[model samples]
Target: MKHILRTSMLVILIIILAACANDEATSNEEGNKDEGADEELKIFTTVYPLQYFTKQIAGDQASVESILPPGSDPHTYEPTTKEMVEIAEADAFIYNGAGLEPYAKQISDSIKSEDIKILEAAKGIDLEAHVHNHEEEGNEEGAHEGHNHGDQDPHVWLDPISSVQLAEHIKETLVELNPEQEEAFTKNFEELKGELEILDQEFHSQLEDLPQNKFIVSHAAYGYWEQAYGIEQIAVSGLSPTNEPSQKELENIIEKAEKHNLNHVFFEQNVTPKVAEVVRKEIGAETLRLHNVAVLTEEDIKNEETYLSLMKHNLEQLTKALSNSKSGDSSESEEQSDSDHGHSHGGDEEAQKIYDGYFEDSQVKDRPLSDWEGDWQSVYPYHEDGTLDEVYTHNAEDSEDMTAEEYKEYYEKGYKTDVDRIVIDGATVTFYKDGEEKFGEYTSDGYEILAYEVGNRGVRYIFKLKEEKEGLPQYIQFSDHSIDPTDADHYHLYWGDDREALLDEVTHWPTYYPSDRSGDEIVHAMMQH
Candidate 1:
């Protein structure tokens, strides 16, 4: 009986020990799950639009923040050491690029960790050139040169269509960082895209038939608007708000405002320069606020303002300004004088061209195959023989951020070609490759506008072969960055048997130049690009 009692006690002890071990194991598993739940992605952005877009897409999967403080000027703002460290430790850093934030590229280069992704929201988007009026006659050479944004305008977020691209990039990056939540991210992006499309339609429907399309603003930050909509912006300042106009330029601006009968002078929410005030006073116009959306004020944040809200507000203000009748009475002779001036608007012929080409449906005109009639040579060989090394170096220098090797690598993918030469005469295209030639009789197949994944768009002037040939491609397309019918100086060519598939080929452009030009001339031309 004593032996049996001892055995029973030993069995009880073993059961208790097993229960304790099982409890400990379960606790550890729960702890690990809680820790994983706490590890949300930390993303840092340089501007408001990127921050907003990231947050909208990330949902509960990440935390989004901006290094740029509210109401701070991105043109002159620099990140503090703490902010830099935070950004370096983040899962990703997104910036607008195109010289919007001068320090962003440097910060990106300094962070060498493979753990983080540095993304440019404006990358691959074809930025519009900033047309400065300060270079005009009678203006001082150094006038309005305080903030230089190079040649390309960086405020691409204002346009709804472009904002969709920005949001798409942000979504892609988020999906890359945390692919487990891809369904949520994709759903969020689709909803956001729908809203943006609706906003774009609203802009078109509301602003299309307005009596006046011109409005005066504090700065030339609305180039996209001028391009997307048929509206004209008479800016009192240069691209940057700090780039105030010269006295002569100011006088010209005031004259143009008066001539246009503009009753409102638009100023930015963050920046309201004295020059803008003076212009408003000179023209006897009411002052209206336009948000750049680069930075939002505290009030804007408190009121829950978003890119869509601000854009809608802008549309409202524009409607009021553009639809309003002449603010003050003017003599019949003054009206006649305005008529005589005939929309010159201080001789901004380039601005007029943008207005003319605003509507894409009306912009592209059909053309014949003669537009590409030239003896062309591929730029690929030049790249291979190191003849284009200097050109690549020049491009890197102008890039303001990328190294020569990086730029060269980037171009290598874009300039790769199997064909060495192409001769287009009349409707016949001759392709020379590997010591053999293929000829095809091609006819115009119209043009198609392609929206690239990068957010920019291109026009492909396509041609179809009349008859199928054994060695020749059935379809050939040319893209020279021109929407209207024009002769090509140099062109990027795509050829395949499937016309629809050829249109979807965004990679491997295989660029060509005039065969008659010397290698140095070709290099110079590429450098100019």
Candidate 2:
């Protein structure tokens, strides 16, 4: 009996010791988990770009999550209660703010913890001016549908420089949240900045010398690019893909496509391309996709398309669009330039009388056949208060010796002789040393205008309008600089509200050409004009 009691006690003691040991181990594990949680910063972003910047900047130092699902449209996305809960619990919530994610402010407000950091990724970047007026009184479940946020275009991340700014914002926030990781975040941000600079350089080099500079896009997201690169984008839809264009708008787009001689209609991965296809078919144009980078498609995720790769792809497509572009109806005219070289506002009665006489007179069927009929003198494409956006001159002397075919060949062979000074003021274009003066007049077709000498047979030159609008100065010619895509000025002249004419002026286009010139200089130049 004594031996049995002793053995039983020994077994009980051993079991108790094992239980204590197990409990202690469990406590240690829990403590370690808590410590690890404290070390990791939980980051939440509203869109792919912000999430991408956060990840690239934070690396392994933080755990980042995008509240928006892949392929979700940022314009229409609304956070669920669960998502709000997640934001409330996160260490930091980062979003592209210039009004892109409408839910961002609301969810951020709902967070109970003051400890959670709410960072706007686009904090330091300048946002484009976009006004979306929401008129539906009943649909105010906080939707951007018809609402306009004045002077705020939330798509800054589309530009690489803006992207760099966004990354810096994220890095600054992360470093603030965890100072211990400051060095790591700074290093990562610097690397990202370098990469973005390289991307910007690539854009400069590749897009600098294309034959055409205008493109049509599904959405007006590329405003930043338009300002930065001097390319014009006519969007099929409004800033939000959800803002479907009316039938008249569709017709207008088709008309512009015809007017611009556009060969491609660009679509986005997130939006349905049905409307884009209709425009494409009507215009006999091909369809192409441009990744907005606001969200990722499943294919993009599966293919692991990084922001850099997607931007590179966009650059390639843009280049292709411009290079393959036909100059509206100027193909024949350009053939002549190789053979021969030749080159809105609703105000000013001289312009109005001319527009009505040449464009609106029903009796003059051939005379008023096109909307661009009127006398257009050359005004600098940008407001005069600044230096000329760009200037290039082509000498006819070089091609004088070549046969029409050989003249064409010379241009095809990329041989160019610079003009001493080329000036176009309103109706006259003069090449000083080249000894050529073109008197421009309107034609039935908007693209091809008539350029003549005192008594010589006229040559046809292609022209474009800033936008499809009715007015006298509606037509502007492409400068010789149009041949070089890199030139800050592609199209020449602005006709319309004097304010609109100042588009390239610093006062109007603060980001245009990304220059260091002050707004005062630009305004001064405009005053001179």
Top candidate (TM-score): 1
In model 2, where is the ten-residue run with the lowest total lDDT?
Answer: 505-514
Query: Clashing residue pairs, candidate 1?
Result: none
Runs of candidate 2 exceeding 4 Å displacement: 1-38, 131-149, 327-529
User: Taking the tens digit of each residue's C-alpha lDDT, what string does model 2 give over 193-229?
Assistant: 9999899889888888787788877777788887778
Candidate 1 local lDDT, 1-529, one digit each (tens): 4433443454445345545555676768766976765589999998898998888888888889988888998877867655766676678999999988867776676664576899999998888877665222343442332256778889999888998999999899988888888899999999999998999999888898887888889878899888888898888777777766678888888888777788778888877799889988887776666778898787577556788877877786677677764644221111100111011111135423322222355667776675676579998898889998996687667666779998678668878888999987445688999989887778888988766553445677889999888988889988764466444667788888999998877656788877877778787655542
Off by over 4 Å in 1: 1-34, 133-146, 329-529
RMSD of 2: 21.5
Best by lDDT: 1
